[model samples]
Target: MSKYDIALERIDAAHKDDPTTITINTTTLPYELHYAQQMTLYLERLDPNASELLRLAIRAQHLRRWEIPRSSYPATKIGYHSWRGALQREQAALVEKICVESGYTEAEAARIGALVRKADLRKGDPDTQTLEDVACLVFLDDQFDKFEKDLGDEDKIVDILRKTWGKMSEAGRSEALKIKLSERGECVGTEGFGWLSVK
Candidate 1:
């Protein structure tokens, strides 16, 4: 098989071993595996011309996330940021190792790792922006309603939407507006993020 295929196979194998499972559309899948699949789908929709490295990075964005539970860090915002930073580094390292083992060069592996690590986000790097867009789109498409319900606070939900909206590019925001949120989610979303007008 090709290096890219081999790397994806290894990543899928690891995700398949996740002890947790979720049912989607009458099929049960490992949670991380399902999440990875969603990320890839969103990335494809966001940028069909994305580089192979970006594709691989998106697929492995949350590699073995359950291994690092959020409870491991403090419950403060600072702790949340710290936990995310650490996860990015850990996921990048794991993906790089897989890339190298699949016959990719160190430089190629490093590029993939950098994408997974979200390097140069504030600098407006195209690949990083694409990744961020995909992430936000995935959240909006699949997780927004559940997230809003779980939070149960309009202000907090709006705050979250504002932050998510800020991270998205225009293309991403356009796609997000197409998502069909629940009635309440749509109402809160429209109120919280003025850019969206849900019908």
Candidate 2:
């Protein structure tokens, strides 16, 4: 197998042991593994010409995420942010290790690590931006319906959509516009996220 395939295999193996399962289309998969697959699909749709490093980073974005439950952190905004930051570091380290073991050079591994950690998001790094775009698209497409149901507040839902919209690139926003929201989410998308509509 190629180095990229080998690295992906290692990442999938780690996810296979997640111990948390989600059923999709009658097929059960470890939640993080399913999530990784979604990220890769969105990355391919968003930028088919993405580099090998970016591809690796996207595939391992949430590697073994179930290992670090949000409940382990304090129940506060600060704690939530802290937990997310730490998870980013942990995922980056794991992906970097896998990349090196799969024949990537140290520099390439570090680049993938940075992308996993989302370094320089506001600095306009193309790979990091693309990763962020793919993430936003995944959330909008796959998670928004469940998330909206849980929140039960239209204003909060729109706020979340607006925040998510702000993080995406024009291309990402265009993709987001195509998502078929539930009735409540559709209202917010039409009223608040309408600005994202392509001409």
Candidate 3:
């Protein structure tokens, strides 16, 4: 079974009737912001109001739970847990930015950030809830709102990966790359989101 399959199973067992799917709501967030584009697409199909932060947290939770590495998990959840402490630090700075931008006290912004992190870091919510999970979940949900309506035939599943294959979580993207290379005899040329093209 694939790495995604393991996470999927865990997610399924954890959120069986809890509605793990996210919905698309571009009014709140956008597709480009979601790091995991495809998974974001998946969530948006489920719920429009899905919070990106919550998604990130859950994914992080999953990673901690399964002990899956960045290379194995989908691109969205890669390095997710490792960046948690950094994300918290950045949010502290963001709180200051928000304070300056909104004319609020730095303390107030800090409080808000604290609440967000507290709520986001639900210990029992998932096995490895993370900030990246929240980011991707929210990002994907936002993107799905705009893109899902355009989806066509189910018979043809075409994944145009915009992220580096190496970063994909649960080896999703790498698995895809290997399959495509072996089946199509092509090699991907570059890195990041922009350089991908079937050869």
User: What ranking of all candidate models by lDDT puts the best one first?
Assistant: 1, 2, 3
Question: Highest lDDT among the candidates is held by which one?
Answer: 1
Candidate No. with top TM-score: 1
Quote the positional error of residue 196 for candidate 2 in Å: 6.9
- lDDT per residue as tens, model 2, 33-96: 8888999999888899999999999999988888888999999999999999999999999999
TM-score of each: 0.96, 0.94, 0.27
Error of 3 at 147 (Å): 14
Clashing pairs in 2: none
What's the C-alpha lDDT at position 186 in model 2? 74
lDDT digits (tens) for residues 1-199 of candidate 3: 5433443344334333332244455343322222334444443443345553333323323222222233543355446655554555554454334334444455544544553354433443331232333333443323332342355322221242233232234323323333322211122122223222532
Question: By TM-score, is 1 or 2 better?
Answer: 1
lDDT (CA) for every model shown?
A: 0.89, 0.88, 0.36
Worst window of 10 by summed lDDT in candidate 1: 190-199
